[model samples]
Target: MSKLVFQSVAVNTDPMTQPTPTPALSAPDLTEIQTGRLADPFSLLGPSHRGHAGHLVVHLPDAQRVTAVIDGTAYPLAAQAPGVFAGMIPPGSAYILRVGNGSPENGAQEWEQEDPYRFGPVLGELDEYLIGEGTHQRLWHVLGARVIRHEGVEGTCFALWAPSAQAVAVVGDFNQWDARRAPMRPRGTTGVWELFIPGVAEGASYKYRIIGPDGRELPLKADPIGFGSEHPPQTASVVRSITGYGWRDAAWLEGRAEAQDRRAPMSVYEVHLGSWRKRGDRPLSYVEAATELVDYAVDMGFTHIELMPISEHPFAGSWGYQPVGLYAPTVRHGPPHEFRDLVDAAHARGLGIILDWVPGHFPSDAHGLAQFDGTALYEHADPREGFHPDWNTCIYNFGRREVVNYLTSNALYWLEEYHIDGLRVDAVASMLYRDYSRKAGEWVPNIHGGRENLEAIALLQRVNTLTYGAVPGSMMIAEESTSFPGVSRPVDAGGLGFGFKWNMGWMNDTLRYMEHAPIHRRHHHHLMTFGIDYAFSENFILPISHDEVVHGKGAMIAKMPGDAWEKFANLRAYYGYMWGHPGKKLLFMGCEFAQAHEWNHDAELDWAALSRPENAGIQRLVRDLNTLYRGTPALHARDCEAEGFAWLDGGATDISVFAWARFGGPGDDPVVVIANMTPVERPGWRCAFPQAGHWDEVLNTDAAIYGGGNRGNMGGVVTEAVAHHGHAQSAQITLPPLSTVMFRYRGAE
Candidate 1:
């Protein structure tokens, strides 16, 4: 007997018959591969050992015939089962799979491509270790579909974290959406599935088809870290390049690091880009908004434009609050690069752009992160810990390190990737409390049995710290309504580490007080003066945001309890008062012109309202107020300092009149602000002045041009060396009816 070997198949050259060895893949493995539930598809499929020869296995249900093409030789693969093809071949480093055409069973078009499983894992050992530990700060750089060149072949690499899944596969147009064709290889212990398919290019739509650990097939899921997604109603994630954007705001960025000081004047114009101004009911593109919104904000003297949430959201009604794709900017406006253009355009016009970020809860859409991997991987498993009653959404499990990293990276993504100047974190109060909107026994308490959500607190602190440290000049503002202490303090100082907090209390109080009839306002005068008691407690932004004008609350102008002319006067007076108040300012889009109707997300603002003089006057008043607030040191220099403000006549409730003085640094000019909330004009109202000098009436809400009766001091009044309101100097001037006035001392007359 002589031993012999074949080139592609090893065999003994004995003349006596000996049965050939069985195939490498058994019947059970073939069944698993055909059903697409094989936990270890890599073990049976792809290249494997068969006796002394190498075997190639491929599962293509649509293919009529398949051949393993190694070098120039084509080896036919026998159909072991429907969609399951296998054959023995010579050992080789590379091979391609050719399918269709040449089979007698079914005649189909022929297509040849590199086998996806032939490539090794895209992520390295460090990536696996960090991801498993949930501390991969730049998870977006790894998990999402990234275009890379592997083995000198350029293609997109798809990776997903589905630890509990029995199997995962990359299904896209390239593979004709066949799950079995591109089965991914599971990395060791990371629960991450990755496959690098050569020749897949940018703009290719893709998703993961995961088989649950229970052996049940699941709905295909969109990529959690998708860089871009199709427009709403289309859930597939699109492969997009995150780089190659040319920024022209270097000067703005450099100056912003030093110029965005707490003491500096910041007047933000909050806008919903979708409803701001649509072209015949269609929303403006990012480029259009860049030119229109940027120029308008600049002309109006606003320092920043706080855009309502722009993250990728499924429902338009949620207004980006129930965002599904945290890493992707919504495609409603335009592509990601166009959004970047909007930010760059804003900076070019010397205006900062602030994004309203929502990280509190996510919608439980079927295609979203809910029940991802058939497990509570991103959220809490218990409803008491994960569900948000108020929002009817799922709260992120901030206690999970991976969830925290996901959110923290999202914050930095907007700031560093898009050059966003700041983020107005939305619904932070809900995130801060475990029993936010739940009744007794309906919520779970922290380890200390308190209402505080310690994990969410820690997450906020870490995100804030990371944001401010990583992105210079980036601001993190909290829309937290509760009295959570030190919200705007540094993280190391045991605070939530926000740059500013929205003054919801002040907004509510002032709005309520303004709603009362002028005569009745005298009794509630405390509402006007009470905010100052704790004005310096936290850095604040006085926001007349969209929330106040929507949901049947009526517009800001409608909140005024007066006739047409009186209403205009009252609103102008309020505008002046707010600009003169001790805090940064934010005004919603239509509030500047006193929009008649409440804000509707479906419609554009009432730009026609400005055609009326009263509305135009309000707009002009707001613009002037912004100018005055930005230019005057006394008004904004120490807006967050207690020593900057003093009450000159806050006790005059019976007369519906209040007066105050704002002081600046030594030698800087001082300003006097007085408001007569009543409809009665006082001819000779005396208020304490900072010095004995000529006090120039810099801004009068009752000026005729501002749709007022022109009842004010003539140009200015000379301060008299008379004791009044606890000051050595006093000025007696005409107080406009239902109006606010501001004066600055010029020099000794």
Candidate 2:
């Protein structure tokens, strides 16, 4: 499949007259070189193959005369063809080629430069072997533009994968964007082209100029493995070195495994950095976020900070979801190192960081991976398998071994290089199904005639395996909505290996129930309790994500069915119930302070609203909730286990009051959570308890400090010996109107 093609150094792109044959060169070889195939440009352009010592050749198009400078002595070379020159200088002597242009009457100008074709390859045999087998875990190190010393010359070693190309040239600012010079050499049978261009160091912008197999020049393409890029609307890859960052998260890294365990409380504060806050007219840069954002999250008692995708994207309206540069942390917020500063700041404060990783699909931008190498090399040719109609993007060909390797290695790069704590993989449900968002006949079936996409499933599994194996304490959470079993189970158990799955069913049901008026909530009571049916099926996170507050969904506060006062009360009660529920927690940025408007990716959050008493009260309630959740073992220790929870009064649907007990290990104390969803208060109403003892009112959603009337059981309650609701002990407690209350048991004396 690897056919040889010749390199062209034609001075004029329009057809040129065939030069008369010389003793040193054949006409067929000259024709191929003039056509620009670049299969082995080194053989045709750089040193003599006819055993003539000190014989140097270079293709300097448009050069009227060429001279070799050795030891400050200039020697003229005879022109073999148009723009092609060769001559003998001192053997084994270091030299530079001086290109002379213009006529003698106008005065000639000379430009001296090193010959790019004189440098040997940076990619050795081992890289080729691993690349051919598609097993290179560190593919980024080899594919992208790496600034290094090749052949005793300081330059950048550029490589690309375009097997079907007739010729590939490195075109950029260094070479005045000329495609004729610096043609890449295709390694035998590897489909990879390599060229080391001297003096092209960091910060130089570049793109690949490729002539397709049919000799058709394709659009200049961005590097798929590029670590840095020019700010968008300008689609050139910038050479960057991502090494030598001194990370300060050694303590956090050592304790991360325990911090991410199921037993640990994971209270995530999800943020869209671009909209979380602003400094005057623009969003905060990564340097600004390092202190402002990290300080805010720690002060609010969040365990981790989950940022929406920050990868380089052309359109800001996509909110970073349709990323073009997977390796690049968007230049919108400073360079890659500043992003590291943000991560380092979080870890310094003992907080974990998680990024929303999108690997399912990408935009069909001209400079992106779509139609790369003038073929469907990264995506599938079939639309049914490779197109995402909903997003208007192209799906990656996970079935291709090399493509899979490329993606899998990218996962490790973030964790290993950036020291990020976790990745919440986005839109996993779409990747799991072959016919996602498609009707019958518009979709394709798998080899087994099923709807499951086996390749994508394998890709997801492999990514989870590799990331977890490489990063000890890192997590791979899934944004999956389907009922596919064992989503959080291990891969060896024949399941998709994820650390946690977003509890979409619980979110949808609970929000639907909360939307109904208090009077009507009794009839729709089953909505809130239905989630308990499969609550412990998989490790879950009760997420109030950005998706819930955008595109006409309204903000969290608006979703409540009540007047001004009741709205605040309802949200506080809901937050109480959510924190007490059996799962991890994740709340979007504005939700903590009850932002009035729906989320807009373009603007900053309405932070001034926090000055209001009601809004400040909501913020205080969330802080206390996080504090209580983390401090109390009974509240979080058994979040993923059935035995850790017990319902006392699920049949209290008529009263709209629910009570449950959360237990820890045998010796650890238990906490009781009671939620009164209705507006009506119940004074001296006997509620069941696990034991006959004095229970302290640990948290009261209706407390006066939280913008509610100070109405609840005073400090503590003592249980009487009256059997009630299948318990030997019952407490005569006061239930505030539309509130949630928590109690901690001391002992039975």
- For each candidate, what TM-score against the reference? 0.94, 0.94
Candidate 1 lDDT at 158 equals: 87
Residue 631: error of model 1 in Å?
1.5
Which portions of model 2 miss their true places by more than 4 Å? 1-36, 48-54, 62-65, 70-75, 89-94, 99-111
lDDT score for residue 360 of model 2:
93
lDDT of each: 0.86, 0.87
Using alpha carbons, what is the TM-score of model 2? 0.94
lDDT of 1 by residue, 249-325 (tens): 99999999655678889999999999999999789999999999999999999999999998888999997899888
The lDDT of model 2 is 0.87
Residue 414, candidate 1: C-alpha displacement in angstroms: 1.3
Which pairs of residues clash in candidate 2, taking residues 3 or more apart in a chain or in different chains? 6-37, 6-38, 7-38, 8-33, 8-36
